[model samples]
Target: MKWLEGFQKLSSVLFILTFQGANCQLAVFPIGPALVNALAGSNVTLAVSFRGAPDPVLTWFKGNLPVGTWTLNSSSPPDIADGSRDVLRIENNGSLTFKGVPKHFSGNYTVELTKSGLGQALVTFTLKIFESIQNVTLSTQPDFAQEGAERFTLQYTMLQGVVEQEIWYFNGGKLKNSTRYLIKGRSLVILEPTRTDKGSYSVLLMNPFSSVTTHRNVTVLYGPDEPIVEALPAQPFYKVGDSLVFSCQAEGFPKPTAEWVFMGQILSDFHQGVLNLTNVQTSQGGVYTCSVLNGLTEEKREKNVTLNVYGM
Candidate 1:
């Protein structure tokens, strides 16, 4: 009976050793990095390695959902493909390759290997797929702003990804936040814009992976200031049959138009900002008025000059 008990104890020790030997031979491990960082539309691979086994059957899962299944000795390919664009296949070494990975494929992935006579083995990996910015556009509500207005806004739109940083530039220089300029989220506000605020404005959006920029041209409409008239000779009196040249100028945003008035009638012969009088007579020597008009601001300014013609 004691010998029987001794034989039973030997059998139990042998069973334990055999079980540990099988566990050591069937150990499985991942071959590559546990974490993968990939860009959208790019390809990536996840690999695993194992020893011994009854020809393991590998299965890939995204989160808790099954992605594909493949048997090592089987002649068939992976049982699943995400879509026509997202091509997925299993290689001979039990590695999964994704061709043209999509943005939505960023998540946790798990691979499970099972053999007929061994315990299952699992390996997990974290995948991060970054989406790049495809396009950017900028626009304004009114396109044109009036000087001394309450406010004007510039808006921006991005094609992909969340914005990590946003910066604005005016006339190729960076814009600062002040009482006149305010930046709120993805919009830029101009408080009481003046003629000096007219220029090219751009907004740049940046993320962890990429950056994009969009630009728009802004115009501020103002008024025509007082007109200045200059005589060619800088003299108040000119002789008969003498040439007289007068120039008028004004300051405005859209560029003001100038007209000349002789006596009480608009001179049809005079155009632009210059008034030329040749062979001046006493009748043409009265008061000459230079009038400037700004169509956008609906403002008009005029300047008058007196000339007396004497007989030569």
Candidate 2:
């Protein structure tokens, strides 16, 4: 009942984005952005400074929700003490602290101040747990590439922390939730990784409390196994109006598609597995590529060859 008196004193503070009482003005200071991101199972601490002095009440929130305990009530010169048992909320050191920020902790928060009237201010921080592991360790297999072996493998071990599962992810660009990912282990090793697999590769560790991620570079092995591409002019020279034949070959678990890339970056419709160019001219000279991609497996292989047009 007496706590209601504390609300009357906080009226001096300005309220922004009211959520409660009329006179209970709440103002969330240093509210820079509405969205944020972080890795899972990682220890993350957020720094927030509030304004409005004289009998002010403060609360801590995660994403759009609140975690642990928010202290807006201790009348004793701003000191942190226990508020509840089952629900963990801390009010100390003039700020709020949450141990090991997790996925479920992502949400919006409000610091409501209630005097005789109820007024609330909002200072929300969104936590998006990343895939970086703080304790566990990760390593890739078959360190060296044999030029064209087209094999890239990565393995991981958790030195500390609890790991529910580990996943290997490969991407040519930015990694997304929809990006291709595989459950990698001793039994499940990475497939043939060609030059294309040299992009960003990362590992994710999933757990109930937190999630972590690690990144590594994938190297292509040399084995002359690259899709061998040969264009016309197999001889010393060639003439115009001549038939240009381009063939691409590669070896891997699943076969890859080989295509011809023209000057316009267009595909010459390959019907019945044959790429034929009719009446080839000097302008048709450019980089021809054989690209094999299976959207399902997220595996792709490509080889390039230059066509030289000469006047015979």
Candidate 3:
């Protein structure tokens, strides 16, 4: 089996809704444009034209990433547009649309055709984005203002029916126009958070019609405590009949692990690092320490306790 790519100007073939057969042709209008910029919560429309193709399958690309294709169920919502704005009709039409949009969704797009039985054609459009005045945005991503050292990616999205002229914002400020980012639908992405970005931000719907806003307060948090282990028996004294219960505890992102310790050694003798002595005897007494460890982060902790042995 061999592959072939025979190009006659382009490779897309178009089929008229009617039976045009091999005479169908594909044409791209607005062959070139600087960009197709839009505000968040806005729909972007592409102007195009097609002709002369037996079967045309639409493929869409943004920047270099494939947004999706317009074949079979080729439906993609624009920026932040409601589902109503995403379908492209007229097998010969050039208008490809992005429904509602988000800040990071701005870029260049190309609507291409893969005509197996005919030819191919590609229409490229550049897209730019701005804060939308249409809807109040909610930052659904976790509030990670805490853990100043850990990097976190936060996400925000806009709802429908916002005042389209109002100023929308994030991270306590408007997104800088020059930042290189990706806007996928009505979603705003914060690549990584830093110390300077710890604060509250809101989406402001400002216009002569009506004004409203949605805000989110972000705060960083830290620390629970080191894990410490101790024997339930009296310190420096344990009787033969006493119940010997060992307790372990720690703190971290996942509430650090607590493990039983005996004679300065961790005891994973139990299925899950748990070790318990049903009854203590004068023969069992020593310095025990709980070892807390998270191998992934290379974080470990240890705290010790001591007990003495006595006859029952």
Candidate 4:
């Protein structure tokens, strides 16, 4: 009886202590996390196990506000004024169930179990309700950026959900906030985007109930570096019937287009950036221009090579 008396004075605590007397016993044990997470519009159960008086009365509360109660062997729960009467259900084993949890119902929940002869036992739980993430899409402003540009932005949007965390990845590696990178609520910005930044980028959005990941391939347009024109023969003058080979090389993101101009006319046959002239003649000696153009960045560059032919 001393243990029963001491139990009666037990203050409100989370699964504080369990007691068992000769004929009467009371034990409340949690089966899951004390902090429960549920999705809005989804059926959720806050479960617990109890060993107490056969005709125990169980009452539920939200913080200091009384929620509802369930009498032993009762089919329906006793309602107070919480409006949970429509969705909340008390199970036979003293567990609470929400037919479809509401986002606004997230808060601390407590359960009180008592009987006439025995003391009261209390268990507390923290409930969190979140909306499911759906229709997630990742995109970049302008879809492409030029190298050395001030900045580029990547953003993601979701149809519904409360994001607890935002994570970004670049080229399969985790991205950290740095001088070159900025993370906002739903966007990521990269300063001075370079060719190295042209790769796969992904973002992860998470919540209590669900998480989603979206990916996009970002493009960073760079150049057509200064073109270089090379000739096979190093001599300034060429002899008739001699073989001459000219090649133009350049570097760029989209592979710059090379055009060979001879005598102010585009040489259609030498569009591949190489010109082959065999059996060189005195009339064929002039200046050759190799023009390199980058369609993406609109960058143009050119190199010139001169040939002088003499008859021996």
Model number with the top lDDT: 4
Off by over 4 Å in 2: 1-25, 31-57, 61-73, 76-94, 98-110, 114-118, 127-155, 161-312
- Candidate 2, residue 255: how far the Cα is off, in Å: 22
TM-score of each: 0.55, 0.31, 0.35, 0.64
Q: Per-residue alpha-carbon lDDT of model 3 for 1-312, expressed as tens digits?
A: 123443432334432424455456665567446466566666667766666563357666767765555542336422322332343232334356656766566667777776665667887777666653445556645555334343443344445443434343656567532342233444444444443454665655543335667777655433335775555543556667676666776655444556666765657654333457766776667777767765434467877777666774
Worst 10 residues of 1 by lDDT: 77-86
Instruction: Quote the positional error of residue 151 for candidate 2 in Å.
Output: 10
**What is the descending TM-score order?**
4, 1, 3, 2
Give the alpha-carbon lDDT of every model. 0.83, 0.52, 0.56, 0.84
Clashing pairs in 1: none
Better of 1 and 4 by lDDT: 4
Give candidate 3 misplaced runs (Cα > 4 Å). 1-132, 135-212, 215-221, 228-230, 251-253, 263-265, 268-275, 281-283, 293-299, 310-312
Task: Give the alpha carbon lDDT tens digit for every residue of 1-312 in model 1.
Answer: 999999999999999999987667565677868988777788888877877775788888889988888888688766874663256777788877888988788889888898876768888988877777667888887778878789989998767765657899999998889998899987999999998899999998876678888889998988787888888977869999999788899988789999988867887666679888899887777788888998877778999988889986
Tens-digit lDDT track for model 2 on 1-312? Answer: 677777765654434325333433434554345455555545554545544443455545444343443354565543323432322334443344445555555555444433323354555555455453456555666664333444445666655554556565666343333323334342224444455555557777775556877777655533224667766547543467777677666664334455656654748666422577777787776677777553334466677777766766
lDDT tens per residue, model 4, 1-312: 998877766743323443225445676777889998888888988898888667578888889988877786876656545677778887778788888888898999998988876788889999888998899999888768778789999999888887878899999898888998999878899998988898999998899668899999988888888898988877778998898888898988889999999999988767469888889888889899999999978989998889889888
